[model samples]
Target: MKRAAALTAAVATATVPLLALASPAMAQQPAKTAAVQTQVLDWLSLDALSGTALAQRVKELLGKGYVPSALNVTNATNPQYTSLWVKDTVGKVNVLQGLSATDLPKQIDQQVKSGFQPKLITGTGTGPSAVFAAVFEKTTQLAKSQLSMSKETFAKVNAEFTAAGYSIASLDVYGTVEKPLYAAVWVAGAATGAVQVTLGQTVEERGKELLAKTKQGLQPVLMAVEPGKLYTTVWSKGSATGLKEYLNLSKLTYTLKSAEMKALGYSPKILSAEDGVIASVWSKK
Candidate 1:
């Protein structure tokens, strides 16, 4: 996943205590679902600090294990002061302020040496000074079930669905396991709403079973799918990273530049003309 962008404030300095403000309304709102909670706060009053000192203080905060994953600094209200939003681990956020370069700690230099570079940092001439940061933690591994797939027999099974009047919207295949294989496809039938077909074990057997099941369970409700809404294919040897993995399978090579291709750990030129190419990047693994 890409790193979150940072927010920046433009004020030079202002007299505001970090702990003097009321808790933000978001802090009071009840948690919903299982998503990460984020909050904004006032970290320091930078009314009297110099630019160098401000930088130092930022270094100090980072050194204490507060490396921001996203950092936003702005100066809209006070010309000198800036507000900051710092998101740390789950349920932890710090809003602080800095007075000057002197007020900044010395740990910032170390952060730059590390990979925690800010995505955006700009200065404006109005509003409350603010900075937003997204702290980094260990990358969470998606569950195995979330990434497993089979490739060998998916084409045949999907073909059966198409023959039964179901439009296959998306076909995803992965080369996991052997013998039975594993595969998944998203299909839209006239009557079955949107359904996902997952095949596990014995590719040929599962494919036959899936064909029979679709005829028995899905064909009765298959609706006429809309035309012109082209379905794009994507393939990747790497683990699925959302829609990006499919880019290679669809052969969208022209859309991928050197930098983007490198970032995805893929080579843009390693594609075939007969293979599916959308926009200019290789869409197949």
Candidate 2:
């Protein structure tokens, strides 16, 4: 389907001096668990795909050594998908889609019993009727996880879980005009450091928030939008050597900006698109 006409010009890029934040050492270490397989990932971004098409494309990519990193239904009403994939040698990854809220938990349990863990989970639609898409990797099970929770419930649990020495491993938002809900997976032995979550922010507001946070060495990890309406984002403290954002751009401008950013050694960390707008965060490779 044709997307809505292009919106305003792209927001200016935000830049900050390199900050010396300590990168996590655990991420680089080899996995000790029998289910764990670790390797470097080469990222790829894809947008404007339908459900059936995305399923087919994912199968092709998996054969070429890529796994899903992020996935969202940008336009739930029209049902367009925007996703990010990482080229890695992760063995035995399972991708599940179109699961009802009731079935998601059972599927997660089944996968875990088969020596897999949920790496990415996204919810689309609202309330009990919502459907989920998830990717499970052969890894140790998470210490805590929840799905299809309301905004208020998620915030409370997110705070409680963070205080208990767990960090959000995967998070996603669902619902557009109505109140949003969240799905998250948390793992033990990590702390949520310098985190920021934005809800119902307009494009301009989100751009400003993005600017302010990146300057303080924060990076956007997850971003979801409600078609032509609000946006939600999650930011966490990170090394901000070459952080930049291009917000609310038309398709043409997004293409132009992406090429320039690639030439400047920047690759996208989070990419969101809806109703003819493309907003993305990029960092130096």
TM-score of each: 0.20, 0.75
Worst 10 residues of 2 by lDDT: 18-27
lDDT, candidate 1, equals 0.26
Per-residue accuracy of model 2 over 1-285 as CA lDDT, tens digit each: 222111111112222221111110112222121121233335555666777777776766676666667776544445666677665654557777666678889887877887777777776677565657777777674656797677789889988988888887777767545666677887776644777778768877877887788788887877765444567787888866677766666555555565555546666777665555666777788
The lDDT for every candidate, in the order shown, is 0.26, 0.64
Model 2 / residue 19 / CA error / Å? 34
Error of 1 at 161 (Å): 34
- What is candidate 1's CA lDDT for residue 137? 23
Q: Residue pairs in steric clash, candidate 2?
A: none
RMSD, each candidate, Å? 22.4, 12.7
**Best-fitting candidate, scored by TM-score:** 2
Give the per-residue lDDT of model 1 (tens digit) for 1-285: 111222222222223223221111112223122222233322311222233444555554443333332222223232222222232323222223332222112212322344222122222221122221222222221111111222434556555655666454322221212221222223334323444343322323433543454454432111110011111132212322221211121212222232243334342221111112111221212
Q: Which stretches of candidate 2 lie over 4 Å from their true place?
A: 1-41, 76-78, 141-143, 249-256, 273-277
In candidate 2, position 228 carries an lDDT of: 47
